[model samples]
Target: MQFLDTINFSVPLLANATETVDSSMVIKSVLLSLVVIYFVSKLGGELSNKVGLPPVLGELLGGVVIGISILHLLVFPEGSTDSSSSLIMNFLQTTAGLTPEATPQVFAAQSEVISVLAELGVIILLFEIGLESNLKELMAVGIQASVVAVVGVVVPFGAGTIGLMTLFGISAVPAIFAGAALTATSIGITSKVLSEIGKLNSKEGQIILGAAVIDDILGIIVLAVVASLAKDGEVDINKVIYLIVSATGFLLGAIVLGNIFNQTFVAIADKLKTRGGLVIPAFIFAFIMAYLAAVIQLEAILGAFAAGLVLEETDKRKELQRQVIPIADMLVPIFFVTVGAKTDLGVLNPTIPSNREGLIMATFLIAVAIIGKVVTGLTVFGQPGINRLAIGIGMIPRGEVGLVFAGVGAASGALSKPLGAAIVMMVILTTFLAPPLLRFVFPDETTTATLEAASGTSLVIESDVITLTDSQENELKS
Candidate 1:
C-alpha cells in the first residue's frame, strides 16, 4: 500500500493519538495566550493611568506592538528564511491534518481548541458589557438616545458612501461597506472615560450610555444590510426587516424570560445558600438566548444585552454581578487584543494616494467620520447646562464596533485594502482623541459633580482625577 493509503487506513489510530496531542497543545496555547494577555493588560493599564488615558488605549497599543506581523518581523530579520519554514508548515500541516490522511493531527486539534476559546472570549465580553449596563437609566433617556443614534448612523453612512463613490470612483457595494463601518460607537472606552472623570452617572453620561446601546444595535443592523447587499447586488429589505423584528422580539422576550428565571434561580440559590450557584444558570440562559438571536439573523451580543437587562430586576443581581465580573475582567481583554491584532498597518502603504481623486475621496470620508456623530450631540433635547460638546466627544470612539464592520467587509471583499486601512486609522484616532478633549471641556470635579447633582444623579469618587489607579470604579446606578 502507498504511504498515503496507509496513513488514511490508520485513521482510528491517528484519531486517538491526535486527541491526546491536541489536548496538551490546547492547554499550552490557552495558558500562553492568558499570560500574554495578563501582562499586556497590566502594563497597558498602568501606562494609561500614568498618562491620564483610558486603559483600553494602552491595551490596544500593546496588541499592535505584539501582533503577528510586527512580532514576526522582529523575531526574524527582513531577509531571513529561517522563520518561514515553521510558519508555512504550521499552516499547511494544520489544514492537511484535518483530512483523513495526515501524520500530525495535533495541529488541527490545536486550531479547533483555540477557536473554541476565542468564541468563549466573545461570550464573556458580551456578558461583561451586559453586566455593566443599567437598563433603567438607559430607558430614561431612550428617546434622545434614539434620535442621536439615528443621526449618528445615517449621516456618517451617507457621507461615507457618497465620498467613496464621488472621489474614489468605487462602486455602491464598496461604498456601502465603508458607510457601514462608520455606524458603530465603541462605548467601552467611553464608559472608562466617564468613570475616570467621575461623571459616569451624569446626564451627559447617561445620554452617552443610552445612545451607545442604541448605536450598537443600529450598527449591527447596518452591517447585516450591507453584507446582504454585497452578496446579492441588491439590498434584502425583507431580511433587514426580519432582523429588526427578530432582534426586537428577542430582546423583549429575553427580558421577560430572564426576569422570571432570575427570580426562581435566586430563590433556589438562597435556599441552597451556595456561592455562585446562580451564575451557571444565568450564563446558560444567556448562551441560549444568544444562540436564538443568532438563528434569527441578529447578533448574539444583542441577546446578551437583553439578558443583562432582564437580570436587573432580580434580588440577587448585585451578587450575580460581583461573582461574574472577575471572570469577565480577566477574559475581556483578549477580545480587545484580538481586535487590535487583526489590524494590518501594511494596508496604508498604497501607491494611489498622490492621485488627486483618491485624496479627495479619502478627505471626504474622514470628514464624514468626524462630522456625523458630532452633529448627533445636539439631539439632547429639553435639557439645559448640557455640554453637547462632551457628548459628541464621547460618541467619537469606534473601537470594537468599527473593527467588526471592517472584518465583515474584508471577508466579503467589499472593502479594499486602502479603505480598510483608513477606517482603522479613523477608529484609533477617535478613540485616542475623546479623553483629552473631554478633560478640556469638563475640567474639574466641581463642574462634573455639580452637573451630576443637577441631573439628580450621584457621583462616586474612587481615585485622584490626574492619577487613576487600576482599581475598578464604583458603579453609580440610578
Candidate 2:
C-alpha cells in the first residue's frame, strides 16, 4: 500500500512539472512574437506609405516576409510545420535550454495564444469600423446593396463552379466547395481600404460596405449547405431556412432596438465614475454583443459591428470615436499581419511538377475571381454616376474570408491538393491586389472633402458668398 501510494504521488509531481514548463514557455514565446509583429508592421507601413500604396498592403507583405515563405520567424504549428521550421522554437532550444521532449507542447501553446490575440485584433477592428460607418446611409442604400451582394455571390459562385466542372473535369461536390469559397467578400479588408482612402462614407463606399455585410450572411448560408452536402450528400433545408430567418431578424431587430439601447448605453456611461468611464462600458457592450452573435451561429464580428452601429447613435459618438482610434491602432495590425503570415505562397511555385497543375488552375480561378466581382458593379439600376467601377473593384479582395472556406473544405476532405492550392493562390492574389486598385479608382479626398463631395448636390450655394449675416455682423462689431 505504501509503495502504491508513492507511485501515485510521483505521477502528480511529474504532471505539475510539465504544466509549469508549458506556462513559462507560452508566455516567453508570445512576447517575442509580438515584438516581431509590431516592428515589421510599422516598418512595412512606413515604406508602403512612401510608395503611395495602402499601408495595409505593406503590413501584409511584412507578414509574408517573416512567415514560412521567407524567414520562418513567425511560423505557426498548423499545416506541415515542424520544430525545425520555427525560429522561435529553435531559439528557445538554444537560449532557454528548452528540452527537445517539451518542444511540441510549448510550440502548440504559443501558437494558440498568438492566434487568439490576432482574432481579438480583428474583432476590435470591425467594431471600430462600425463606429465610423453611417447607419442612415447604409440603410438608404439597402435595396441597391442587396442587389450587388446577391450578384457578387451568384456570379462568382456560378461561374467558378461551372467552369471547374466543364473546363477541368472536376466533380460537382469539390466544385461546389470551391464555388462557396468564391462567394465571400472580406469586408474587413474592404472596409479598411475604404477608410484609408477617405471613401468610407461616399455613396459608392456605403453601398459596398452594406453589400459586403449582406454578402457575409449569404456566404454563411452557402457554407452550411455545402458542408452538409460534403458530409451527407444533401442539403439541410430546415437548417438553411433557420439561418436565413435568424440572420435577417438579427439585423432588423438590432437596428430597431438600437434606439432604446443607445439611451441606456449613454446612461450607463454617465454613471461610471472611474478612469474607463466611457471606453470600458463600450468594450463590455461590444464583447457581449459579439458573444451573443456567436451564440446565434452568426459571425462574432457582425455582433461587434452591430454594437458600434447602436452606439453611434448616442450623443457621445464623436468622443467615443476619438477614444477608439488609439485602441484600434494598437490591436488591428496584429490581425492583418497574422493574416499575411498564415498564407503560404509556396503553392504558386511553378518548378515543382505537383504545383504546375495548381498554377494553371489558379490562373483560371483568378480570372473568374476578378471578372465575377467586377460585373457586380454594373448591376445597380438606380444609382447613376455611383462610381460603379470603384464599387466593383472594392468588392474584389477575398482576404481572410476566402481562407476560412478553403480551410473548412480541406478539412472536410472535399478539396483535392491541387484545387486547394489553386483556391489559396486565387485568394492571395486577390487580397494583395484589391487595395491599390480601389485607391486608384476612387478620388483622393480628405474625410471632410469626401463628405462635402458626397453632399455637393444638396448644398445650396446662395449669392451671399463670403457675406456675413446681420446677426453675425452685429456680434462681430460689438
Candidate 3:
C-alpha cells in the first residue's frame, strides 16, 4: 500500500516536470538558431567581400543555403514549415529529448522571438540610414524628390495594373494589388547599397533617399486603398483620408519635434554619468519615436529614422554615429539573412508545369518593375549633373515591401497562384539583382581611389568612426 501511494505521487511530479521541460525547449531552440544565424552570416559576408560584392548579398545567400530550399535547417511558419517539418525541431527531438507533443508550441514561441529580433534589426537599420543622411539636404531636394516619388508610383502602378488586366485577363482588384507591389522602393536595401559603395552622401543618393521616403508614405496609402478594395469591393474614403492626414502629420511633427528636442536631447546625454550614456539616451529617444510611429499606424522604422534625423543635428552626431555602428553590424545581418531564408525559390523553377505559366507572367512583372522606377530619374528637372541612371537604379529593389503585398493578396484570396508566384519572382529578382546593378550604373569609385592612393596621396584610417578625407571634408563645408 505504501509503494502504491509513492508511485501515484511520483506520477504527478513527473507530469509537472514534463510541462516545465517542454516550455524550456523554446529557449534551447532560440539559442541554437542564433548560433546558426551567426555562422551563416559570417561565412556569407566573408565570401561576398572576396567576390567584390556587398557582404549583405553573401549573408542572404547563406540564409538560403541553410533555409527551406536547400538544407531545411532554419525554417519559419511563413515559409510553410511547422515543427514537424523543421530539421531544427527534429534535431531537438532526437538530441534534446523534445517530445513531439510539445514541439509545435515551442517552435511557434521560438519563431516569434526571431521574427521580433529581425523587425528590430530593420528599425535599427532605417535609423542608421537617417543618421547618415543630411536632413537639410533631404529637405533641400524635397520638391524634386516628391516629383520623382509621384512619378515612380504612377508609372509602375498604372502600367502593371493595366498590363495584368489586359494581358493576363486578371481582375481589377488583383491587378491593382499587383501594381501596388511594383511601386515599392525598398529604402533599406537601396540605402544599404549606397552606404556600402560610399555614395550615401552624393547628390543622386540624397534625391534617391528623399524619394524613397516619400515612396514609402505613398505606398502605405496605396496599400490601404487596394487592400480595402480587395475586402469590400469599394474604397473607404474616410480610411484613405485618415491615412493621408496621419502619415503627413506624423512626418511633419517628427521634423518639428527634432528642432525642439535637440537642446533637451543634448542636456540629457550630458547628464548621464555612465557607460552607454550617449547611445542609450539616443536609443531611448529612437524607441520612443518608433513607438509613436507605430501608435499612429505608421511604420516604426519611420519614427526611428525621424529620431536619427533629429539627433543628427546635435553636436554629438559623429560620436553617436560611431557608437551606433557596432550595434548595427551585430543586428543588421539577422534582417538580411531572414529575408533570404524566407525566400522560396522553388516556385521559380520551370521544371514544374504550373511554374512555367507563372514564369511567363513574371516576365511582365519583371519588365514593369524595372521600367517603372527607372523612369523616375528623368523626373528630376533641376538637378543638372545628377547621375540619373544611378538615381533610378537606386530605387529598383522591392524587398520586404513586396512580400507584404504578396502575402496580403494571398491571404485575401484576391490573387491567383500564377499571379502570386509571379509577384514573388519579381521581388526576388529585383532584390537580389539591385545591388549588383546599382554598383554597375555608378562610376567606378574604387578605381578612382586606387589611382589617387597610388599617386602619392595616401589614405588614413583615422579611427573606428568614419573620418572624411581632408578634401571631402572641405567639400562638405563649402
Candidate 4:
C-alpha cells in the first residue's frame, strides 16, 4: 500500500503551483482584499463627504478599521501575515504538504512581493503628485517655506528627543529615533485637507505645500542620521552631513540631466512612427533614475518624483500622467491598505496594563508629534492673516512619510520592537487625527477665501492652474 505524504501535498501547494487550479487560499486573500478595499473605500468616501473632510481621510480611517487588529478579528479568524509572506508556500501547504516551520520561508517570499508592489505604488504616487505640483510656485515660496519647514522639523525633534531622554528615561539612540519619527510632515493628508477646504491655492496653502516638501527632504536626512546612530552607539555627524550634501548634489545633477534628456527624447518622439514607444523609454528612464537614487542610499521615490517634475515641462507630460494614473489608481490603494493592515491593535489592548509600556510610549510620542508641528505654525514670519496654527495642523499628519521612516528604522534595527510599535501607533493616530482637526479648525470655503483675499497673494491660483480644455472642465465639474 502506498500512502501520500500529506504534509508535502497540501491544497495550498497545488493552488500556488498552478494558476489554473484556482487555489482557495489565493482566492481568499484576493477576495478578502477586494471586499476590504471596496467597503473601506466606499465608507471612507461617504464619511468624509458627510463630515466635510477629504476622502483620503475616510480611506485612512477605513484602513484603520479593516486592520487585522480591529475589524479583521471578526472577519478573518486567522491573522493576516506581514506584507512579506509567500503565497506559493501558502498555496502548497493548503494543496500539498508543508509544516509550520516552512511557513516562514513563504512569508519571506511574500515580503519581497509586497515590498516591490509598495515601492511601485509610492513611485506612481509621487510621480502623480509631482505632475500636479507647480514647481515654479514651490520655488517662489521656497525660502519662507524652507524656514518654516526647518524650524518645524528642528523644534519638535529637539523637544521630542529631550522628552524621551529626560521624561521617558530612554537611551540616546532610541531618543534620537523617536525624534526622527517626529520630523516627517504627512504631505498626502495635508494636501487632501487643503484641497477639500479649497485652500490648496491660497498663500497659506502654497507655503504649507512648499514647507512640506522641504520637510520631507530634511526628514530623510534625519532618518539617515538616526539610522546611523542606532547602528553605531554614536551619531556620525560627518556622514549625516555628507548624505545630505550628496542627496542635494544628486538632485541638482538629476534635474539638469533630466531636462537635457527630456528635450532630446521629445524631439525623437515627435519623429517616431509610433508615439507609443515613447512611454517605454520614459519608463526606462524613470526606473534608471529610481535605481540610481537607491544606489546612493536615498529613497527611489525621490528619483521618480524628480523624473515626473522634469517630464512635466515636456509636451508629453500630460500623456505620461494620463498613462500612469490608471495603474497608480489600482496599485496605490494596495499600498495604503497594506499600511493599515500592519496595525496590530493588540499592542494597544490594555488587558495587561502593566505590560503596556509601548502604548504609553506611543501616547507620549503622539503628544510630541502634535506639539512639534504646532510650533511650526508659529514660525511663519511676515505672512499676515495666515493661520500659522492651520499651517502647523496641516503639517501634522504622518501618512506615507512616517511609514517610510518607521520602515527604515525597523529594518535598520535602530528601532526596538517596543519603540517601532509605538512609532506606528503614533503614525496611525496622527494620520487619522489631523484631517478631522483641520476640518474643524479651518472649516468652509469662506474662511479660506477670506485668508486668500487678505494675503493679496494670487501666487496660489497662478501656480496651481493646470491647463483645462472645455471638455476637461466639464468632466471635472461632473
Candidate 5:
C-alpha cells in the first residue's frame, strides 16, 4: 500500500485513482511472479546439484512448487469462474485482447503471456544448441545416426501406440498422441550429460548427439502428421510430404547460402568499420529462420537448429557461441520452469478412481519408452568397441518435445487431463532416469588434469589417447 501510494503521488498521472491502483496491482503481480521464478529456480538447481541430479530437474521441480498445481502461489487461475477470481480472470482476458465475456475459454487465456515468454525461451535455447553443433561432424556420423534415429522413432512410436491401445484400451487417435510424445530426444539433456562426463567427443557420444538432432527433425514431422489428423478427419499425405521436403530444402539451402552470406558478411564488416556488425546480422538471420520455420508449419526450433548449423560453418562460430550462451542461460530456464508449472500431478495419482486408468496408461507408456530406447543400443552393431548402451541411455529423455506433444494433444481435446498428466510423468521420469544410467555405463574419462602432477607432460586428453594401446599401457605400467 505504501509503495502504491508513493507511485501514485510521484507520477503525475491523468488517469483516475482506481485506474492507477489497478495498473499498479498488475505490475506488482507480474514483478512478484518473475522474482519468485528466478529465486526458486536457482534454489531448485542448487539443491538438485547437491543430490547428484541435473540442474534442469531441480529447475523444473521449482516451477512445480510455485505453479498453480502445488502451492497455488501463481495468480493465474485455471477453472474458477466466480467473484474475485472471475474478475481477475476477466482482467487477464481483457489484457489478452479478448472480449472478456467470462467463459471457460477465459480460464485458459490467463497464462497466455507466460506461455509466449516460455516459448521464446525455448526458441533461444534451440538457437544455442544449433550454434554449438558442427555440420561436418553431423555429416560424418550421418549414416549411423540416421539409422539409430529412424529406429528410435519407429520403436517408441510403435510401443506407445500399441502398448496404450492393448493395455489401457485407449482409442486410436489419443494413442497416436501418446506415441508422438515418446518420439523426440531432448538434445539439451543429452548434450549436458555428455559434456559433464567429458565424453562429448567420444564416438558413442557423437553418434548419440547426431542421432538426437535427426530425431528432433523426425519428431517434428510426426507431430505435424498427428496434429493434422486431429484437425482433419483424414491424413493429408501431401502436407506430410511437403513438411519433409520443405524442412530438408530449407536446412540445406540455408547451409549453402549461409556459407556465402558468412563470407560476404565478414568481408563487409572488415571494409565498413561498422560497430556491432556481424552479431546483429547473425541474430537477424536466426530469428528470420525461426519465423520461416513456423510459417511453413514446422517447429521454430528446427529453423533455429538450421540457423546454428549455418553459423557453425562460418568463421565467427566461436564468437557466435560465446554471444549466444548468456542469452540462452537467461531464457532457457523460463522454458523448463513453465513446462514444469504446466504439469498437474493430481491427475496422475493412482489412488483417485478417476485417475487410475490414466495411471495404468502412464505406467505402460513409461515401460515402452524405456524398453524401446534401451533396445536401440543393439542397433549400433556396425560400430564395435563403442558402448551402445550409453548411446541408447543418452537418447531417453524427451524434455521439451514430449511436453509440446502432450500440450498439443490436451489443447486439441485428443487427450484427457489424466492422460496428459500421464505423458508429463513419463517425460519427467525419463529425464530423471537417463543421466545416472549414462554415468554408470560410460564413466567419465580420466582428464589430463588428473594425470598432471604425476606425468608433468602437456599431453592433450583426446578420446583416442584416453584408450591407450596394449604396448602403451605396458610402458606406462613400467
Candidate 6:
C-alpha cells in the first residue's frame, strides 16, 4: 500500500522533461520539510515523555523552537506566491489568487501542502478519538457524567468569555471563540494517566472518560457556532439557533444513517476475499463523512467523529482501529507541530508590559480551565466510590483538542495572533499540570476492582440510581 501519500510524490509526471524537473523539485521540498518536521517532532515527544509530560507538549514546543516564531527556520508562503520559489503558490495565484493582495515567493509551495495535511491530521485524530468511544458505555454512565460534562464545558467557556473581554477588551465573538478553545478535555492524556495508575476501569475513571467524550461533542458544536458567528460578522439570534440545531441534527442523522450504511457495507466487504477490503471501506466511510461535514458548514472533524462512532460498533472495529493508528501517528504530529509553529511567543514576554497582558490572559485562562474541570469532579457527588477531585483532575488537560480549537479559530481569523498564542499557552500549562495533580488525588488503588470492592456503600442521587461511596458526607464536605 502507498502510505504517507500526502507528503509522498507518486503522481505520474508529464512526458515533457521540464515538467518532470519541476515536479521533482516540488517533491524534494516536501520530502525535506517532512523529514525535518518528523524528526524534530519525535525528539520533542521523546523529551516530553522523559519529563513525564504528554508527548504532545514536546511536539508543540519543538515546533516553536524550529518555527518562524523562534529560530525563523521554517518558512512557508503565508501570503506570498512567487513562482520561482513555489510552484503551488504560482498555481494558487493563477487558479485561486491565494497570495493576498500582491506578493510573490518561492520553494515553500510544499509547506502550503503540508498545512493541508496537518489539517487532515487533526481530522483523523478526532476520528480516532471517536473510534475509541463506545456510545453505549457513554450513555450508560448516566446523569453524573452528564453533569460533569456540562459543568466542564460551561465553566471554562464562561471564564474565557468574561476574562478575554475584561482583560483584553475583546468583543463577544472573539471572546467566545477563546472560551470555546478552553472547553475541550484531552482524553488521550487523561486516559493514559488512568491506565498507568490502574484506575482506568474505576467508577471515577469511567465517568471521566465518558465526560471527556461528551466534552468533545459539545466543544465541536461551540466551535461551529462561534466560527459561523465570526464569519457572518453579526450576532443574530436566529442564525445562532439555526447553527445549533443544524449541528445537533447533522450529528444525530449521520450516526443513525451511518450505522445502517456500515452494516450493509461490512456485509458486502465480508464477501470479498481481497486484502484491505474491510479497512479500505472503513477509511472511505470516514473520508466521505468528513467531506459531507464541510459541505454542511460544520467542521470536517465532526464528520470524522461520526464515522468513527458508527464504525466502532462493527465486527471489524479492533482491526480498523489498529490500522488507523499508524496513519494517525504519522499525520497527527504534523498538526501539533504546525500549531506550535504558528504560535507567536512574543506576546508571552512578561518583561514587556504590553506582552505581559497576554501572559496575564493565559494565566487567567489556565486557572479557569483547571478550576472548570475540578468543578466537574465535584459534580460527581451523586456517584459513590468515585473520587470527585480525581475526576476533575482527569478532565483538566485540554491537550490536543484545545489546540485544535485555537488553531481553527486562528485560521478563521476569529482569534488574533496574540490571543491564539495565549490560548496555546493555556493548553500547555494545563497539559503539563494535570498528571501530577491526578496522581495526588488518587494515591494507591492497585486495581479498579479493588476500588469498587472498597466502595461497598451506596448513595442515592435520583430516585432509583445508586452510587458507591468511599468517604462520609462530612468528609466530602471537607
Of candidate 6, the 10-residue stretch with the lowest lDDT total is 1-10
Model 3: what TM-score? 0.90
The segments of candidate 5 whose C-alpha lies over 4 angstroms from its true place after superposition are 1-27, 74-110, 192-201, 268-275, 416-418, 439-442, 449-478
Tens digit of lDDT per residue, candidate 6, span 1-478? 0012223233223234253334454455566567768988999988976876557667778887766567644445442323344333444446644443322212434555667777788778767766666756655675778789899999989988997898779988879998988888876567656654556656887788768756766776676678778888755666557656776687779757855876787797789788888778877888899887776656676677678778877766766777888988899888777756655556557787656656777888888888877888777665667678888889998876787777677767887766776887888778767766776787753222212224676443432112223244235545
Cα lDDT of model 1 by residue, 296-349, tens digit: 766666666567667756766667777787877776676556545444444334
Highest lDDT among the candidates is held by which one? 2
Q: Find the number of clashing residue pairs for candidate 1.
A: 0
Clashes of each: 0, 0, 0, 23, 0, 9
| Candidate 1: residue 38 Cα off by (Å) | 1.2
lDDT values of the candidates? 0.64, 0.84, 0.83, 0.67, 0.70, 0.69
lDDT-better candidate, 4 vs 5: 5
What candidate 6 gets wrong by more than 4 Å, as runs, is: 1-22, 75-108, 142-145, 163-181, 184-217, 220-234, 397-424, 431-478
Worst 10 residues of 5 by lDDT: 1-10
Identify the runs in model 1 with alpha carbons over 4 angstroms from their true place: 1-21, 72-119, 187-189, 192-199, 258-262, 349-363, 431-478
In terms of lDDT, model 3 sits at 0.83
Write the residue-wise lDDT of candidate 5 on 384-462 in tens digits. 7879888889899887677778767876899877688789888877876876777788754545533433558665564
TM-scores for all predictions: 0.77, 0.90, 0.90, 0.76, 0.79, 0.71
Model 1 has an lDDT value of: 0.64
Per-residue lDDT tens digits for candidate 3, residues 190-306, read 888888877887889999998998898888889889989999999999989998999899889988988999999889989998999999989998999988887776788888888
lDDT of 5: 0.70
Q: In candidate 2, how many Å is residue 326 off?
A: 1.4
TM-score of 2: 0.90
